[model samples]
Target chain A: MNPTACILVIGNEILSGRTQDVNVQYIARRLAELGITLAEVRIIPDRRPVIVDTIVAARAAFDHVFTTGGIGPTHDDITAPCVAEAFGLPWVIHPETFRLLEAHFPQGEFNAARQRMATLPQGAVPIPNPVSSAPGFSIGNVHVLAGVPRIMRAMFEELAPSLRHGTPVASQSWHALGLYEGALAAGLTDIQERFPGLDIGSYPFRRPDGRGGVTLVSKGLDPAQVRAAADAVQALIAQLGCTPIEGEPPP
Target chain B: MNPTACILVIGNEILSGRTQDVNVQYIARRLAELGITLAEVRIIPDRRPVIVDTIVAARAAFDHVFTTGGIGPTHDDITAPCVAEAFGLPWVIHPETFRLLEAHFPQGEFNAARQRMATLPQGAVPIPNPVSSAPGFSIGNVHVLAGVPRIMRAMFEELAPSLRHGTPVASQSWHALGLYEGALAAGLTDIQERFPGLDIGSYPFRRPDGRGGVTLVSKGLDPAQVRAAADAVQALIAQLGCTPIEGEPPP
Candidate 1:
């Protein structure tokens, strides 16, 4: 079985509709490439109890738990101390992180607020930040990352190599123009039953010209099974009187 | 206190990194406008047990629970039946939904798979789908919506009037170029303490001209409190030697 992971997005901006999260998609895709199954994503607010509770729950459930946001220098940035509390560890300042931040800032520019970035959970290891000086940390299986897209991507890339991986999933898609999903649902269900190991999904898309179509995707750990299912889906689309197109159709 | 809501996004495509969700942000913004506090968002797969468990938990936790995706005609579309099971109601064909689908499809074109769209929990009220013939149902406080962006928006707008609301949140923002978030964190923290009713957040941005800046936003139910916090934030920026702009900087 593949190792599973969950993402905890800790930010009030997301819940408030003030910001759209790109971190979940980025981490999901990256974890997929690393052969880890991205199981769940929870977008919660910056509240202390909620964050701590979510972290504990996710840590117990998944092999790896990644949290983004609330790691900045501001007051709302409470992820570090809260995560420490979740693991029953003391929130302390890391020496290496403090040195890195001190070197990055100008003379006397690093104040008490800026120094908060250096504080992490006891026994936590730093996740380097290429975009800025503030570093994220990892305690146990939870890897904390910044909410900013660029910084999150950089931190994830740097930390991904250390994570354990499983068999990478392979996927293939077949699209047919002018094909309604409802019309093809029965056939798709039959195909899904035939290949129980594979996951089959049908999505409908509308074109700018007012034409709509359906796209059938099959994914699995076995490449051959995925290919066979894709071929069957394509044949099914052809049987429905529509030409099958490889990949997604343009809008 | 504002009435709270939660969004449950049910789809494998989102967890698999094949699709980026826009529904959560849309729902959050709309709920905020309706004076509903969107407390949490959970993105989970189309699994039966997971969906049922999440639905039950969310219904118990929030005043309103909105779910998007898995209400389609395909086999992966299992949300309706799962939701029915969650409420301990037998899944039955909603008569009105069947009538609507029958009228929408041509004679003899509505297949068994299409008929599945009419299925809903017993005693559930149908939420009209203006974009598609298949209707989403509402049982108790849980309002199920479509996965497609356009259809989801239409369904939400139609149902918004019936939902209980609180005082609408008011917000104001101040942007300043050459202002680092770390530098202004102390002052922002002070302002946040002073305006206990407001939610103050600091976000950093990279401008097109390669300049970095921060945008401080204050949100609250009281307009005067929001405005007061916003003014304080602007003054803090000016005191730090950066002129504050009233809104978002041009990308």
Candidate 2:
């Protein structure tokens, strides 16, 4: 089984629709490439108790838990301390983190608020931030990173090598124009049952010009099974009187 | 208190990063306009037990629950039955939904799979889908919509009038160039304490030209409080030796 991961997006900006989340998709794609199954994603607020509860619950459920946002210098940046409380560990300022931030800022510029970023859960290792000096941290199975897309990507790239990988999933897609999903569903169900190990999905789309179609996708760890399922789906589409296209049809 | 809502995005495509979700932001913005607070969002896979569990938990936690996806004709479309199980109600085909689908599809095209879209939990009312004839259902406070962005938006717009609204939230924003969030954090904290009713957020951004800045946003139901907090934030930015700009800075 692939090592499973869950993402906790922590922020009020996202919940309020003030900010569109770019981190979930970035993390999900990267995890897929690393052969990790991205199981779930939760967009939560900056509430401490809720953060702690989600962290504890996610850690217990998945092999890896990634949290983004609330690790900055502001008063609302409470992720590090909350994470410490969740694990029942002491919130301590890491000497190395302090030194890095100290060097990054000019003399007499590092204030109390800046120093807050240096503090992290006990025994947590710093996740480097190439974009900004303020680093994220990883403790146990939880990796806490920045909410900003650029900084989050940098931190993830730095820490990704340390995560354990499983078998990378392979996927194939077949599309058919003028094919209603209702016509394809029964055959698709039969194909899915025949290849229990593979996951088959039927997505329907209607173009602006009023042309509509269905796209069938097959995904699995076994490349051969995915390919076989894709072939079957293509045949099914042809049998339904629609020519099967190799990739997604233009919307 | 504002009416609170939670969005449940049920799809393996989202978890696998094959599709970027456009529904959450749309729902969030629409709900905000309707004076409803979007509290949280969860993206889960096409699993039966997980879907049912999340539905039950979310229903118990919030005033409204909006679920997107898994209401199609395919085998993976199990949300209706799972929602029925969650409510301990019998899953049955709604006659109106069946009539609509039957009328929409061409003669002899309304197969068994097409009829599946008519199924709903007992005591549920159908939410019309203008984009697609396959109607979504609202059982109790849970409004089950489509995963497709166009269809989802249409369903939401139709249902928005029926939902109860609260006081619409008001917001103000101040931006400062070349201002580090660390330098402003302490003052922001003081302002936050003084204006406890307003939610203040500090977001930092780096421009493509390498200049960085911070944007402070104040949000609340009270417009006067939001404006007052924004003024204080601007003053704090000026005190830090940076000119505060209203609204977002040019990228």
For every candidate, what share of the true interface contacts is present?
0.78, 0.73
Q: Model 1, residue A38: what's the lDDT?
A: 93
Off by over 4 Å in 2: A206-210, A248-251, B208-210, B248-251
lDDT tens readout by residue for model 2, A203-230: 8877888888988999989999999999
Model 2, residue A82: C-alpha shift (Å)? 0.6
DockQ of each: 0.86, 0.78
Please report, as a residue range, the 10-residue window in candidate 1 chain A with the lowest summed lDDT.
A242-251
lDDT over C-alpha atoms for residue B231 of model 2: 95
Cα lDDT tens digits, model 1, A1-251, are 99999999999889988898999999998888889999999999989999999999999999999999999889999999999999999999899899999999999998999899999999999999998969888999999999999999999998999999999989899888898988899999999999999899888888888988987899989999999999999999999898999975433
Candidate 1 CAPRI classification by DockQ: high
The top-ranked prediction according to TM-score is: 1
Q: Candidate 1 at residue B48, lDDT? A: 95
lDDT of 2 by residue, B26-51 (tens): 99878888889998899999999999
What DockQ number belongs to candidate 2? Answer: 0.78
Backbone clash count for every predicted candidate, in the order shown = 0, 0
